[model samples]
Target: MARVVVDVMLKSEILDPQGKAVERAADRLGYSTIASVRQGKRFELQVDGPVDDAALASIHELAESLLANTVIEDFTVRVEDN
Candidate 1:
């Protein structure tokens, strides 16, 4: 089987309250070297056959249409090495 990964993240301009909260918590926990944080979503898909260009294209389309909100988020699709 082949695997594909889709990573979805909010746009830089959008506010990420959850990420900010985590960052603050980390600072309180004494992780001073830590910088900012942004949260995102990851989706892993398993395919029954070899990964090809057509499959990649389809996955990209799916990412754009269902995996992410294009107005506020961006997504990347890639094949995962087994």
Candidate 2:
């Protein structure tokens, strides 16, 4: 078995309203060090594979096709062997 980790995030050029909301809250809490904030998604799945390069590619394709919308977001995938 292999474990796959996927990180989904909006493109930097896209405006992140939720992130802005968090930034607003941070500012309210007097956190001056936080210059910006962006919300993202994280997903981990156990895939049936030997954890090779091709298996990793399949995981990436699965994430791109079903897990995330590419119009405004990007995804990165990684696989680990068990």
Candidate 3:
């Protein structure tokens, strides 16, 4: 079996309140070196066979259509090493 990973994140122009809250918490915890934080979502899919170019293409389409909001978010799809 093969594993596919889909990572969805908001566009840079979009405000991330959850990320900001995390950053603020980090600062209060004395993590001064922490710069910024951006929260995102990750989806893992298990495929019955090898992940090839065609599979990647299909996953990309799935990410675009179902996993992400194209207007304000971006997503990347990749195969995960076993």
Candidate 4:
């Protein structure tokens, strides 16, 4: 079995309205030192493999295909010995 970790984040140019809204509210509450806040997603998975380069490539494809939207989001992949 192989373990995979995926981190998903929003594109920088895309407006993070959620973060902006939160920052405005916090400032109103006297937390103005905070400049920004971004929300992201992290996912973990287990797969069967002898765990070679092919397996790793397939995992990346799966992440791009189902978990991440290539246009507005970016993703990083990590593999761990398990």
- lDDT of each residue in 5-81, candidate 1, tens digit only: 99999999999999999999999999999899899999999987778888888889899989999999999888888
TM-score versus the correct structure, for each prediction: 0.95, 0.87, 0.94, 0.75
Please list the residue runs of candidate 2 whose C-alpha ends up more than 4 Å from where it truly belongs after superposition. Answer: 80-82
lDDT of 3 at 60: 88
Residue pairs with colliding backbones in model 3 are none
lDDT of each: 0.92, 0.87, 0.93, 0.84
- Find the number of clashing residue pairs for candidate 1: 0
Clashing pairs for predicted structure model 4, backbone only = none
lDDT of 4: 0.84
Off by over 4 Å in 3: none
Error of 4 at 12 (Å): 0.6
Query: Deviation in angstroms for 41 in model 2?
Result: 0.2
Query: Candidate 3's C-alpha lDDT?
Result: 0.93
- How many residue pairs collide in each prediction? 0, 0, 0, 0
